[model samples]
Target: MSSVRRIAREEWRLWLRSKVVVAAALIVAVLIAVTSILTANRIANEQAQRVEQQVAAEQTFFAQPDRHPHRMVHYGHYAFRPPPPLAVFEPGVDAVTGQSIFLEGHRQNTAMFADTKAAADLGGFAALTPASLYQLFLPLLLIVLGHALFLRERESGTLAVILAQGLPGTKLALGKAAALLAVIAMFMLPLIAVAAYSVTLGERMLAAFSLVGGYFVYLCAWGAIVLAASVLLTQRAVSLGVLIFVWLFAALIVPRFAINASSAAVDAPGKIESDLIMLAEQRKLGDGHNAADPAFMQLQAEVLEQYDVETIEELPINWRGVVAAYSEAELTDLLNSYAEERMRLEASQSRIFGLFGLLSPTIAVSSASRAIAGTDLATHHRFLRESEALRFGFVQALNEKHAAELDYAIDMNRNADEAARLRARVNASAWQVLDEFRFAPDGADERLGRAGGSLGILLAWLLAAGGIVLVAARRVRL
Candidate 1:
């Protein structure tokens, strides 16, 4: 045991003395730091720009002159999905998904703008924020540095000499693993610091903690796998090559294949198909503009009767407002239902990829990281749901105001001069009274519960890999 410890210590000293290894480690560390800073800055700037545009658009829409309440319904409103606070760490699927959606009466608009997939092939490689760097690239570095730890010693005839001195294989493997674990810890320090800072900055502490915990287990799994490979391979070159191949398969090939396969499995309909389907469903409900349509006229009569008026024009409530409210409700229902179905498809796609975690710890780590950062597919779906709700609420509030405050006789009759006047006026104060959209952050307990499953998977992988290391130690030959 003492001999094994000495050999491990010597290996660590030798690694430190090697200028090439030291330089490579430094270079990777610098790249991680720079990438994190740059990504954070870029996302912050983009968010600022988006907020400005959203505010400007909202102001312009509200500045419009009063028109038929139905006309205002058609004008609709835009809802912008804001970037999550910790998005800089991962960004995840945000770029792939649309960021802004237009909500109008009687029509459901597919979200528009922001498609990361349109970028060139190499774009993914360079999009190495903290999560990608640690979850994808750092494991490869660990393999490179640690894969030949035992194999090289054996190849060079050092392992037999150390073992002849009564050192057990288990001790030798554990000592080497300890050394490699130190290297992994150093490699992860900067990222862990960033996560801690994020927590201090009011990001969910539990999410950040989960992010760090998942990463630790992921790196440890890499170390264990490398140790096992080292013990199994008789030659240093063979061990290194095998470890590299494993890293490539686990980190790159398998993940890409899973994504493609999951996407195909679900057969997610295109935006156009979604929109057209919603439209068809909506037509079944009475269109507000079809005045002579018996169903719509009947609804109008029912609304008038409910308000205790013989005619729409005689109602204290504005008939145009009432019609707009009903129309908005029907349209909102259609959009919400369609949106939920589409989101379910996306969630299914994610689950398919998640099942591949057994083959690739990279997949597990990436998924866990994004989940904790609130930048995964699940988080994106939540944003869409909330945005849709806010849009409906905003539009409905305006419709209700039209119903309660406007003069029904003038609005319903559309007397030429009166109609013209109504179309040209609305109080600015009324527009100002509309609430601005604000997204609430998820609570700590929610983030923990959400990431718990992914974290458990990663820990299980780590334990299985560790078991492999134990098996390798027992069977290993100098």
Candidate 2:
């Protein structure tokens, strides 16, 4: 322990004497602080903006004057998925998946306002966020700092002097690693502070915990990898080159390959294909607008039979409204079928991507980060599902109200009689009876459960890397 402490102090003193290391460390600290502040503020602003927009959307939806209920269905409401607090650290697929979806009757509209789809005038690309620094830059800095930790001693023939002085290679390796750990801690201090602040948010507290815990292991693994390479390699240049190449391959290149492979192996329908398929299925089911269509005629007959009425006039409820309700229910079923298929495909892709976690620790860390932050594909899917449920319920309620409130005489004669048309217009107060769309985000327990596998993957990498480092340190030679 004394030797390890002495060597750690020795390594620290050397770094202090070097102006290059001091400047780089200072610059990295400043960058982390700046990025953390800016990203957190930006995410908070966007989240608040989405909440305001959602309220406005709801207000506009129900604020209509007396009109036909079907008009309200077509008017539609917008559902906005608010960003989670942990999004300040890792926004994940939020930038690409869009934030707002138009939930209307008959159509499952695509989400809009994706950052990637922005035109040049609309802010062409996403600015560098804090997550970018954590994923790409910090590891590179660690690599550059520790690439020659022990290799430099070997290069300078200090390894002979140190060994002759009776210092074990393992103790020397442990001390150099302690120095790297201190440097990594400096980089993480700002991020940890931001995460601590996030813990004040309800569900994100646990997410912030996972983010902090996962990254701790993740960055330490990198330090171990760097230390192992330095101690094992005889040449300083070779150690630096090999470590940099490994970093690039694991962090940058392998992830791209993993995504490509996952996409290819899992045959998922694209947005265009999914949309076209949904439309075709809806068309086959029936057109809700055409009352005289054969499909509608059958639906009318079924409702008449169900009500024990010989004719539309004898039915207690408006037959047109009944048909409208039935049509919506049928269409929603089709939409759900397609949605489930799409979600299943996505799950397959995620499963395949998990395979790459064994090959690259970055894959596991990225997955764990997004899952805990509630910004992963799973959360987006949950948003879509909740929005859909609300849309179907609201649309169905309107359709049912259209049937119950309007007299059959008014519907039958509305085309020719102005008085009947006036009678068919339901009161605007009807919209108030409907419930608002409220999406309750998953709780901490759910998020922790979802992120567990990815966390395990990171832990596995840490353990494997630690084991290899011990072995490498024991065998380290001049």
Candidate 3:
């Protein structure tokens, strides 16, 4: 162990003496700092903005003047998907999938105002965020600075000299790994500070720690791979080429391939296509706007029989309201069914991508980071589902008010005259019956559970790399 420490100190001395290596490290450190601060500020600003918008939306809904219940249904509401506390660390899919949804009767809207288009406006490399730096650039930096670790020593015949002095090969290997770990820690300082500050953003210590830990494991795995490559390869140039290729393949190629593979595996329908299908299906159910349509004649007959009345005019409740409520319930079910199918297909695609992690630790760490930060597809879907629930409940409450409160005489002639329309409107106070929309994210335990598979794969990669380094170290010779 003492020998290992001495060798590690010597390696550090070499790094400090190399001007190019030192300059590169400084550049990365500065990038980490800048990206962290900028991202933090952006997240804080968005969070505050979303909070204000959500409040305004709620207030506007409750402040509307008396209007027909169906009118209130069309008036609708909005649900803003708040940024998770740790979103500063990992934004995940929020950039592309959007952040706010418009909730109204009989229609389910996709999220709007995603940052993807704005990011493109800035430039493609605008994604040079802190998370991207960790996942892609840091390892490349390591390969550039340290790919010659063992190869240079072997080419200079230092291995024979060191062995001649009775120093074990394992110590040299472990020592080089220690030096690389120190470098990794140096690059991780900005991230570590961000993680600590993340605790203050929310009571999510488990998630924050898990996030940092995943990155740590990921970087260490790279370190181990670099060590093994340096020793196993015969020439410094060859080692550099192989390590660079590995980095590119693991970080870039594998992820893209996984995405393509997943898309191929699951032929999920596009949004417009899905909407067209749903609209066609809805047409088959008849025009909900017209209760007198032959398609709803059975519903009218059922309502009349249930109320023991000869006609809709003599029935107890307003016929339009009953039809409105029934049609909405059916339509909502249709929307939910489609939503469930879409979610299932997406989930399947995600699973297929996760399986590719076996080929690249980068994929594993990326998945785990998003999952633990509560910014993955699952979280986004949770927001959509909860928002839809709120929409349905509010719409149904309006339907109930339309049935129980409005006079049928006024409803049938609501458009007949301004006076009749005025008579048909219900008090705006009725909207107060609906509770405000508040998204409840999954618990920390659930997030950790979801990330368990990726974490396991990362651990496996680390162990395999470590094992290769250890076994190869034992056989090291001049």
Candidate 4:
């Protein structure tokens, strides 16, 4: 181990002395700093902005003047998803997914204000973040700097000299791999600092650690592959070319192919189709407001008997409000049924992509990072589901207010009588009692637990790749 450290130190010095390598390393370091700072600041600004928007939405909802309960329902609400605490470190799927949703009566809305869509609207590309810099680019940098590790030693005739000096080929290869790991640590420092800060703040610490672990294993895997290629191949240039091709195929091409294949494998229902189905299902519930409709009349009769009243006019409750509440309950069920089905299908697609991780460990690591950070499709679906729950609760609160506070006479005569219209307006304070939509992210432990299998695959790849390098190093020829 001491000899290995000495070898690593000597090789690192060689890297430092190479002007071209030094310059490349410096550029990569600068890029890391710039991306870390810019991404942190940008994500923080967006988080604060979303919080402000949420506050404004709540304030506006509760500040409305006296109005009919149904009017308030139509007035609607806005809900925004605050990016997860660790999301800036690994934004994952949030870039393309929408961030905000509008909640209203009789309808479900897709998340709007997506950064990807906004970028497209602006006629420019979406900016890449530090996550991509870490995941995609840094590995390529490793290939550039270290792909010729063993090959260069062989080419320069140092293998015989080192072996003749009593150093084994395995130790030489391990030493070079160690040197590369040391360099990789420099590229990883920014992420380490971020994760450390997250831990101190007690913000998704498990997920943060899991994300860091996954990346560590992923980079180690790349190091192993680079070293293996350098030793197994006959020439330095060919080694570099082979590693670059591997990086391109594994990191770039295969994931794209896997995504295309997964999309084909799953039948994810589109938003429009899901909405149409929900609407059709809701329409089957009949005219809830029209008490003369047989279905509603039956409901009205049941309610009248339940309340021990002979007519709705003497029922001491607004029949319209009762009908609205019942209708909303049924409509909400339909909404959930379709939403859940569509979400399940979409999740199936994501799962299919995950299975493709076997072909490209990059996919496995990427999925693990996103899943652990609570920024994947699953977390987004959690947000949407929770938002719907909040909508139901808030809307139901209003409906209950209508039942208790609204007069049947006023509701029945509002369109015909101005005085009745004025009387139909409920207290604005009613909105104040309802809670705003708040997204409850999955616990770090839960996310970490869920991401364990994918992380395991990354570790498995690292181990397997390292084993290959070890075997190759053992058989290196003079």
Candidate whose TM-score is highest: 3
Question: What TM-score does prediction 3 earn?
Answer: 0.97
Model 2 reaches what TM-score against the true structure? Answer: 0.95
Clashing pairs in 2: none
Better model by lDDT, 1 or 2?
2
Candidate 2 local lDDT, residue 91: 75
lDDT of 3 by residue, 1-478 (tens): 4888888889999989999989998888888888889887777677777888888999999999999988989999999987887788787887878899998899999889744425543664545668888999899888977798888789999888987888888888998998998988887777778887777877388888888888999999999999999989889999998998999899999999999999999988855678888888887776667878788889998889999999899977888888888899988898889888988898899999999999999999999988988889999889988999989999999998988999788899988888887898899899896668766457889999999999999999989998898899889978
What is the TM-score of each predicted model, taking all chains together? Answer: 0.90, 0.95, 0.97, 0.95
Q: For all the candidates, what are their Cα RMSDs to the real structure?
A: 3.2, 2.2, 1.7, 2.2
Best candidate (score: lDDT): 3
Task: Return whichever of 3 and 4 wins on TM-score.
Answer: 3
TM-score of 1: 0.90
Global lDDT scores for all candidate models: 0.75, 0.81, 0.86, 0.82
Candidate 3: pairs in clash = none
Expressed as tens digits, the lDDT of each residue in 92-180 for candidate 1 is 77767777888666665666764443356246653667788888778877877887888878888988987887778888888898888
The global Cα lDDT (0 to 1) of model 4 is 0.82
Q: Write the per-residue lDDT of candidate 2 for residues 441-464, one digit (tens) a residue.
A: 577778878888888988888778
